[model samples]
Target: MLHTLCNVESGRLSRVEAEEEFTVDQLAAKVGMTVRNVRAYAGRGLIPPPRLVGRTGYYGPDHVARLTLVQELLGKGYTLAAVERMMSELPDGAMALGVFQTLVNPWTPSEPEELDELQLAEAAGIPHDPAIIAKLVELGIAERMDNGHLRIPNPDLLRTGLEVIKLGVPLDAIFILLPKLFAQADAVAKTYVELFRSTVWRQFADAGLPAEGWPEIQRTLENIIPLAGQALVAAFREAMAREIEVVAYEELGLDPNTLPSTG
Candidate 1:
């Protein structure tokens, strides 16, 4: 019997004997995949071909790990082609699997919620105005379902909109500002994405991404998510302050010296 240390939490093996083997059916059962799927994966080079053992073929721990990783990636909305490409990018090892897992794990803190039309309207502090609801959908603030339910992708944002509405901001004015805000946000997002691609991803790609460097690449990605969020918020705060100051001076006829320094 070959010894294997399975980390049940991650459904990955921390350590396993290379010689530990299973037949296709057994391997599929162990990895929670269908035997046909296992064969397909082998056929497509998603998993390595089993070792020839006389008349039968036998797969080992590496196959198990790879299959588990594939299932994980697929669960996270990756297509088979994308998973194949991602797998090809990493060196073959358990560490690579762990790194990819971390890289693909959910980074956002919020989960989307499904709400009825009344609930959504209540959240937005708005009456059942089809035009306004359609506007919200267009803004990507909420998604309308075939069942006439609403899926709020970010409840916090919805709550913020309600608060703004409560503060006497006209719904029309809010809707008018959303597209401009979204455009600016899209541009900012592109800049950050390019920064990550040019810096961390470029270096890893150029270095050929040795197994030893996987942790560093993973760490860089993990760090970038929260850091990028912080940077965006800080920049927005500064920009908002500056704009408010200008409005106070120009439109409100307030003295520049009387306004607080945005800097």
Candidate 2:
């Protein structure tokens, strides 16, 4: 039988097989593990033993979750013994599963898109500059696939770069400025991430991350994702306005304070 559960991060309900049963082979297939590995995990006490009915054994959702968690931990370079200790520390069932899901599911603004060579060149307004394309790839703006196609990870950023190029900015100048912009953006991102880490995540950890509060914590993170962008834009505009005024006063000798008021 299929079951439904709340997707805490998106505030949407997702259908998961809560009570569905699986044979050892079915469980291995379901969790993308080999049967031998599944048996080893069960034998090693890394996961709970299946329920035996006569000659057959059945696995459930909790077993699937535990196996997934183990796989994720192993993928991250944790030893099997370390993974066992980590799982042993956490409370079973919903609490462990919720925490794992939260860690695995990050908030992404949008999906990446693939573009042909001609389309990428048109977007960047550099029709035949192999050097510019190389620079873009080096800067992590886009990636060149094995098939020679390009994948634009952040289309909005690419479009913004194209707009600047359309303003007659020299390619060399843009390339130099792009790295500085990225560096500054990285610093800002670190500050914002630290803010969230110190506040919300810290509180969650301090409270022992109770299962009852997982949904609320997830909702808070979801709300923060967009709100953080809005806040950054608002702050940047204000800073830019102040800096523009200062630059005009120094370079063009035009002081806004001394100008006659329009009113």
Candidate 3:
């Protein structure tokens, strides 16, 4: 008996713990594919070659699973090239996007808490207003449940916004400011993603992305997810410090050259 492994989120499937093996025709019949298509997929390196035994070849559960996945993706309107790239046989574009989407998380990871409208306002130190609640929903900060409860996706973000509100920034200004800040963050994230696309992934693709090389590539991608955030924070802090010094010199009649030295 063969056990099929389904990774629905990533659109990948594999079979394991099976001793079942089939010839080309049988393999195609089992997966509801043609012999020619199976051979074509094998040629494209979409599926690993069948185990060789003398002049004959035998396909196993892995082939069945991979071919099934390909059929499913095709049925769902994936281009053949897109599928090939996902399998790392063709040049990567969408494939890289999918990889990064899986690897990267833009928001900070934290436990979410549910709150009612009144409780949410208490938490954020804001008044309970339906208009403001609508704004929160628009900003994706809270979700309106069927029962009128609001779901806070990121409580830390709520606390941060509350602190900004406490610092004399008007609620209306916060709304306007958030979109611009998000746009800047999007641009920064794109830069880092493109850097990976052009440098790390391109080199890997050029090397034929061998079976043994995947672990290293995945590890590198995982490392980039956190490192990009850390690098961005370090870069932003230095930029902010310089901007503050210049602002003080111009607006506050302070000596920029007399700024406190870190050393």
Using TM-score as the measure, the top candidate is 1
**Model 2 TM-score on a 0 to 1 scale:** 0.66
- Model 3: how far residue 58 lies from native, Å: 20
Better of 1 and 3 by TM-score: 1
Task: Give the per-residue lDDT digits (tens) of candidate 1, residues 1-263.
Answer: 00011112222223345767999989999999899999998888887677897989998877888899899889656999988876655445566566556656756568877888787677667687778778888888988877989888777777777899999999989888878987986797678768877887777657655445657766876787788889989988899888877787887776767766666
TM-score of each: 0.67, 0.66, 0.59
Distance (Å) between predicted and true CA of 12, model 1? 21
How far off is residue 237 in model 2, in Å? 2.0
lDDT of 3 at 4: 9
lDDT, candidate 1, at 40: 90
- Candidate 1: residue pairs that collide: none
Candidate 2: where are CA atoms >4 Å away?
Answer: 1-106, 256-263
- 166 in model 1: Cα distance from truth in Å? 1.8
Query: Among these predicted structures, which one has the highest lDDT?
Result: 1
| Candidate order, lDDT descending | 1, 2, 3
